[model samples]
Target: MEVDHLFEIGDKIVYPMHGAGVIKAIEEKEIQGKTQQYFIMVFPVRKLQLMLPIAKMDDSGMRLVLNMTAIEKVMDMFRQGEIDRSLTYKQRYKINTDKMKTGKTQDGAEVIRDLMLVKKEKALNSNEKMMLREAMQFLISELELSNSMTEMQAADLLNDRLNVEKDAG
Candidate 1:
């Protein structure tokens, strides 16, 4: 398997389990007398730091942000709003968690889709609601940064595609 250099120092990247983080530094260090390179990433929101070995980057499933075309596809799915809502919460949660673990941008988008479907059905539990908010925030921030749009504008675009009227009484 080829390992693509998907991140650079000072760049922001998203960890599937950790959400978004900035690459604080890249360093060569000796581990057990062997030289290894690592990307030091810090998650400001979680106050967490991760030292990811470069050799394991692909195994770790790290990836660059989705391109504009991919984002448009995800938005189309959101607009379609055709996800099955009959699945039990546990089943839905497992599916979303698996998607997150895959660390693919499309999987992340699927998480957003599932959460939005849950919300629209008024089927989200408290924990699920919190997870949904985090997932949406993470996805929106990356999309906004990648596409050079404001966070609010990005969110509004998604809402509009989903035909969700904000502040509708």
Candidate 2:
């Protein structure tokens, strides 16, 4: 399969479950006598470099970072009310994890928004707390890139916006 090489070096992209990164290089290597293309991505959040095979990129849920307009739309999602909290934690976990796997900004916002509501109500189990932390960090990192703001600035803005909604509710 000839995969689309849509990403260029220096392009910022998001790898689901891994957060956002920049494409540092594209390389082809032969393994088992088969040559394949790979995108070398540098994730600032984890300070890690990964080689993602181009052919599998689409299936991996890798995507470009949200543009400013799309970021604004995601911010709007935060202003909306929380999702249904009737489900047990296990059920909620599955739904939220599926949203995270989509690598879509709005879906990510949903995960963050729902989890934030849960945190407000009571203590989250360790798993839920870790998920909240990861989701928040991912949102902050993407906001930094899309808004051209520093990490601290992005984080503060995110909290301020969410807090406003929290206070209103």
Candidate 3:
């Protein structure tokens, strides 16, 4: 969907690098002697605001939150531990970074899933650990809000799914 059609004030969106943010407003501004439109997003938890030029929204990879169907698919992948988990750290980092840069919710889900798996197997390096924590918190917050559940409940659901998968594998 086009960014303009997909986004509006009060809409919740996921920015790849920034996680979940709400659309605070859309406004016109004068930049470089031209009038331009921009989407203003507020990251409440982080206490930061991001402004993206409307003309560059798509290229910037701004995206809406996952729908119920997509959320379910992500949960299914988590439950089945479907992602390959044996890649080198550098390879894994590159892959997950690419996924995030694409602004695809499912890709974010995969990164969360894989990182959780890695965490289960062994301790992650500092950078990996930090990224995993950020991804998990982002996924949980968005899922909880979208699914109408508490964050703890959402996390419990993920843990239960991971436990089941660990048992099966």
Candidate 4:
């Protein structure tokens, strides 16, 4: 039987709060007496795999990895995105967490930009530090597939851009 698939094998898609992965297979699985088509994907950088029911792809918040032009635009936004220093810790954390849920590369970049700027002023609390790490990983995962960058290359490029403000300061 032909399967109606939102993403086929070899497609790069990002799952919100989970990072990005490449679709590796489509298989039919029986669970709780329900047989359904699922897409299997491997997340290379994070060294993980995921299987999602094809019917629930939209609910899962999966989207195609940013294309070349879009990725470039995101990079520019990352560099230009401003940090609001007046927000209380509670407010900032809430905003950042909401961004992560959006699963947009741009939102992830904004989280990095805001927290990194905060770090430059004062050490991040444990929660902020963890958020920064996860944001960086998520951003890197997308860059790897969307921009054809190695992990090191993506990390270096982000670090380099993050340092632009430091040089000017």
* Model 2 weakest lDDT span, ten residues long: 76-85
Model 3, range 87-169, lDDT digits (tens) per residue?
A: 88999899888876776667777887788778787888998887777777667666765666776887887777667776776
Q: Residues 1-169, candidate 4: write the lDDT tens digits.
A: 6876568899999999989889999999998999998899899998999889988987888999988678767767654656687899999999999999999998998898888778878999999999999999998888888888898998887778667755754
Worst 10 residues of 3 by lDDT: 77-86
Which residue pairs clash in candidate 4?
none
Q: What are the per-residue Cα lDDT tens digits for candidate 2 across 1-169?
A: 4657789899999888878889999888787898999999998877889998888886898889988778877877776776576899899999988988888777888888888888888898998888888888888888887777888998898899898878877
Candidate 4's C-alpha runs over 4 A off are none
TM-score of 4: 0.91
Question: Whose lDDT is greatest here?
Answer: 4
For every candidate in turn, the CA RMSD to the true structure comes to: 4.2, 2.0, 3.4, 1.7
Best of the two (1, 4) by TM-score? 4
Sorted on TM-score, best first, the list reads 2, 4, 3, 1
lDDT of 1 by residue, 1-169 (tens): 3436868888867777776667899888888898888999886656689999998887886666676787787656554445675777888888887877775666766777777766766877887887777667667766765676777887777666556522231
Which lDDT values do the candidates have, in the order given? 0.72, 0.84, 0.76, 0.86
Each prediction's TM-score versus the true structure: 0.74, 0.91, 0.80, 0.91
- Model 2 per-residue lDDT at 45: 71
Flag clash pairs in model 2: none
